[model samples]
Target: MISTLTATHIQKSYSFEGIEQTVLSDINLTFTQGQLYAITGSSGSGKSTLLHLLGGVDTPTAGKILFNAVDINAMRQTERTMLRTKNIGFVFQFHYLIRELSVIENVALNAQISGINSTEAYDKASQLLDHVGLRQEKLKYPHQLSGGQQERVAVVRALINSPTFILADEPTGNLDAHNAQALMDLLLDCHKQWGPGIIIATHDAAISSRMTHVLNIKDGVIL
Candidate 1:
């Protein structure tokens, strides 16, 4: 399997009161295509921070992230920005939908931002909404939907770009047990269908067990 993502000697830190707080240290890992991988750890375990660095959403204090063997962290800011927009999709604990947009509209927003026409974006959005079992709620605003339904919409939105990788941070953190399972199933379904490599930061053991491989992050390194 070809590697979709590669990281080596990754170190991230922030200065607080003239002291360096290292969130990650000497981390190395690779994620290949068609695999779902989970990073499980406690709340302050740097899992989310690692995910951000993997996706090029944040720069690491040191080391490199490679997508298709190209070093993302070494790229110019403009290049990395384009790479992120074109190659990666992200989801989070909260579904940050625009309050004014309906479900379908929210999904279409990603396509629109990527320069797709409104009609075509809407068509693809409709298929995704239907796939997520939310076709009936297409016209409803995010505020009008339940938490799980809104999360489904968020997932649909994440998949609209047809990205090469999907990075999710605590995706089920805000859901009830039933809803969390449903959301996890939906994510795996999409992962299978889309064939994008998945790197999820999750605390749930059940969710970790469902993935292809599990990496436990403890004290800034994967163990």
Candidate 2:
């Protein structure tokens, strides 16, 4: 079956002091496995907020988010977290690798959290590291690697669970031109191999131009 992540008329609002601030308004979208989607918008355009909602990181003030037709928003926090760990991968703007763990450990940690055998997780992590040319650095700590390498490790960590969807927020924001392109190339390579639904939030037009399924958000609405 084709797995899907659907957002239905989602609305998100925050009450600061006495006023209400809406970040996303009546958003509706469905993301299918094995496709890539690029969400492009300027700063404070609600791109990140929309991603957070879709990833089940936050509850929508109105409407519901369904994963495989079940309302995830209604699920308990624990259940939602479990669902996210097992089915959704996330690559953030900064590489959040544990400062103390070695490269392989960082990548395999996710799979281990999902209850995979340690040996199996490590083996898979090794192979993925090798694929991304990080095998030599597997035993090294995060601070020992370059910025691009750290981000690549983060990507592998996200893919460790073989999640059906990947939500990347400004993943390339910190890299230079060369490293940024290399990182994008690496992500596409992973996408081609793993066939996950890759949704990236980026302000770079050049990157967004590469995706066939592009979404532009403006003023909390899809344009």
- Best model number under lDDT: 2
Per-residue lDDT of 1-223 in model 2, one digit per residue for the tens?
Answer: 8789999999989899899999888899999988889998888888888888888887899988899999998888888888888889988667689999999999888899999999999999999888767879999999999987888888889888888899998887767877678777877876787788889999887788777699998877898
Candidate 1's C-alpha lDDT? 0.85
The global C-alpha lDDT for each of the candidates, from Candidate 1 onward, is 0.85, 0.87
Clashing pairs in model 2, backbone N/Cα/C closer than 3 A: none
Residue 216: error of model 2 in Å?
0.7
Off by over 4 Å in 1: 1-3
The 10-residue segment with the lowest total lDDT in model 2: 174-183
Residue-pair clash count for candidate 1 = 0
Candidates' RMSD to native: 2.2, 2.0
